[model samples]
Target: MIGQGCLEQDDLSSSINIMECPNVISINMSASTSPISVSWEEPTAMTTDGKRIAIFNQSHSPGTSFPVNSNTIVTYVFDDISVCSFNIVINVKQVISSPDACECEPNFTFLNCPLNITSDQPAFCGTVPVNWTEPTVIDGCGGSSSVEKTHEPGSEFPAGVTTVTYTFTDSFGNQSICEFDVIVPVVAVEDDSVPPVVSNCPAHIYEVLEPSQTSLIITWDPPTARDDSGLPVSLHQTHSPGDQFTAGGYELVQYTFTDAAGNEAVCEFAVTVYPNGVNIDTQPPTVPPTVYCPAVSYTPPIITVYVENEATSADYNFTWPTGATDNDGVTPTVIASHQEGIQSFPIGFHRTAIFYYDTSGNRKDCYQNILVRRQGSAPTPATVINCPQNVYLEIPEGTSTRVCWEEPVVTDDAGNPIAATLWQRRLHSGAEFFINGNCNEQFVGNTFYDYYGNVIRCGFSVTIRAIGHENLPGQWTQWYNRDRPGGNCDCDTTPSTACSNGEEPIDVQCETLAGDDWLTVGLIPSAPEKRGQVAYCCPRIGFYCWNRWNALYGQQCLDYRVRFKCPLQ
Candidate 1:
């Protein structure tokens, strides 16, 4: 054999000792390449069993790197002329996976929180599908995939109120939850024919703007609508509260509300703003408030004067304005064609025209119709008393008597004499009347005065009579008086008038129509009040002789009130 040919088994063909390999070795790879050392037991050959080999050789020794895919190790041994060699296999540990650290922190905030959503139910009653934006969350330690949510986007939801909750956890197991509602109506609404009811709708709004202001900011409660059906409603307006309004004629603001069933209701109002020193007097004035006469009695021609500077309290309800006002902060000049208190207005209607004028000659005309009414009650008829009864006088023979009495007095309920005018209206305020059928010598019944006129009757009576004296004997004497009362009395002294049926004449004899029977005994020249006038056939009838007296200046007698002397029957 040559010097390196000792590994060849040509001479040791007969002693064939198999070369054994070391068991497969395994080593893990590290950050750096670290070698692993391997060893193997030498096999015995025909030459000296386990004796030391004359030549030992190995492909890799200790301190040799054995990495993955590189695990072969061979060893060769030769004892004298016999030798054996084998290979060793090594396995390096591979990294299948790596463990991460635990993270838990409650100190996390949500970048976005979901808001409550409202949606109408489907026309056909059923569950409705709803969608919402996902909430954004920020946590230093975690983000599993997205955020933890109870319901996903575009999820089916039953009608009625439903709460959706979102939960979050941090590295240290700290958990927090954010929730919102997914409201959906369970019952579908019917087709609505009626409109929504609007409330708090404003009337025409009027405001005065300052001279320096170009626009006025008007604030009012927004109109609200209630759906006839129990469903939600939406409102849209042309203007909102606190919006600016310029001065023109009328700036109309309209509001529309729509219900779930596609029914709509509208509310509209005008905002009229006028600049200073300008007036918007368009309509006619209404009827003024009713006024009453304060007099206790019915008095005609009441005069009421309205003071120019007097300010009446204007707590009226949109009727005729109590007084005029100016937007320029000045008392306006008032021009009224109708007189308030000066004119004698009956308890009825009176028309008035009012004009409001500024210093700049800007005028606004208005008309008001006033009404007058009576107040209190009318006084009752006046009370009259102290009327004399029927008078009877028995004067001595051939004498007259004076008839005098207290007049009737008038008084009120309080015993106080009422005004003369009041007495005139009810009591006998006119002249006293004496009613006799014809012109004759007689004292009529009494004094009678009508109430305010002769037409109405109201009076007391006064009567006077005389007694005749007996001249000789067999003459029971009594005075007979027929003052303007016609027919014949037989001069018989009786309390009542005794009329002689046709069998008696007037007074002298109850036989013929001519003689002393019709001749009256005495005459009262003046008012028949003087006593001791000439009686007992002394002269003639001093008043209206009427061809019966036959003497000088007898026919010149005026009206006569005669009483005759008669014999007691």
Candidate 2:
């Protein structure tokens, strides 16, 4: 209005009469619903041409209440808007309308993310093995995704606890993880049981009747052992120190048997024998009778008896009479005695005085009669009693002394027979020393003058005059010296040499020792005195054998008898 009409600058010239048009309509885009199409109805009569006109403008805030662009207007076809936002204003003769509204919500779709894992698996016991399966995506979501698998206890899972994991990835690059468990089991086993046994003995073992028959030999084979079935067992043999069972002669022996299970048993055996029959006898050994003189009253000597293994069961005994005489009228006498059991006669001389034997086989005996004789009554002087050379005293001057002859023996020269006067005497020393006093058989001192006191010497001669009248008296015989005088003391005075101290060198040291030294030395170098003698009688008499003696003296003289009688010479 101000530009098209002629304008005059006048204030208030009737207010120019201009009425304001009504507000224009608008198309709005709501923030809650974006990317939408906006539309509105047209405004009224503001452009008088009466032609329908459409004007679009971006809205600037026309009022203080709404936010819009002031100078923008947009025009487009019905389908021209896409993904855009705006507040639009319309002017068509003052009215405009918004297009059909269209809104696009944010494009929406979900993507699934499965899980996956990677780790080692578990192990098993002993030699047991294991199986494993990888984890898989069991659950799924909206969008497509990839799943990856792995084992917790890797490759080999033992007979024990184990686990596996699965991981999934979505197209949106999201991921998830899951797991499962696995289990395993195992087991074991074994065996044992048994016993032992034995077998039969050997046939070689048996009894025997031999020299060593009292004992029996035994032999055997080793035994066998087995399980409850039958296996060989062990055997061992043992014996005692004196055990006779071994090949040698021992008293006892032992053997051992053992089983496979180490058990044991023992066995043993023995032997013995007895004795048999026998006999024995005993008798006195027989002794013989003996005679002394054959020409005179003769008699047999007595005898003795003996035995072995006899009825006495030992050396036999003889019950002899104390005064037993021989068949020859001779007295019996004991010589010697002894005892024998086994080798009685065989071991020594047979018992000449008896007989003997025992339960066993044994025996012995002897011979019988012997001869003896008696002396004659009358006897001639057989010998001169004193020495032919007379003896003298140490004194001289011819001291008076008696000279006499004795007839101690009264037997005949041959010891067989004699006359009534069996003894006689002779006077030879009477001429040397005169007889002063005389006894019936012996004369006293002889009378002689003594001129000097020194030793003297003398001798005399004698003759035998046989005076037997009967019994074949022998012719007169000359006298012979019987005994000589002189030596008296003759004995051994010696000692033994033995030392009690066990000392050495006995000859010197032992003799020099005190105490019994002298006696010991005497015994060391001297020998005992031994003496013996013999006697003979008439050969006509059975007693011609010699009668010996250890020592014979004047005190032990004896007489003999002649065998036949003879007239006086």
Best by TM-score: 1
Q: Which regions of candidate 1 fall more than 4 Å away from where they truly are?
A: 1-140, 143-162, 171-180, 186-190, 226-232, 280-569
Residue 90 of model 2 has an lDDT of: 19
Q: lDDT tens digits, residues 320-377, model 2?
A: 2233333323343332233223322221112233322111112222222211112222
Candidate number of the best lDDT:
1
Runs of candidate 2 with Cα error greater than 4 angstroms are 1-300, 303-354, 358-369, 374-551, 555-569
Model 2 scores a C-alpha lDDT of 0.25
Query: RMSD, model 1, all Cα superposed?
Result: 56.9
* True-structure lDDT of candidate 1: 0.41
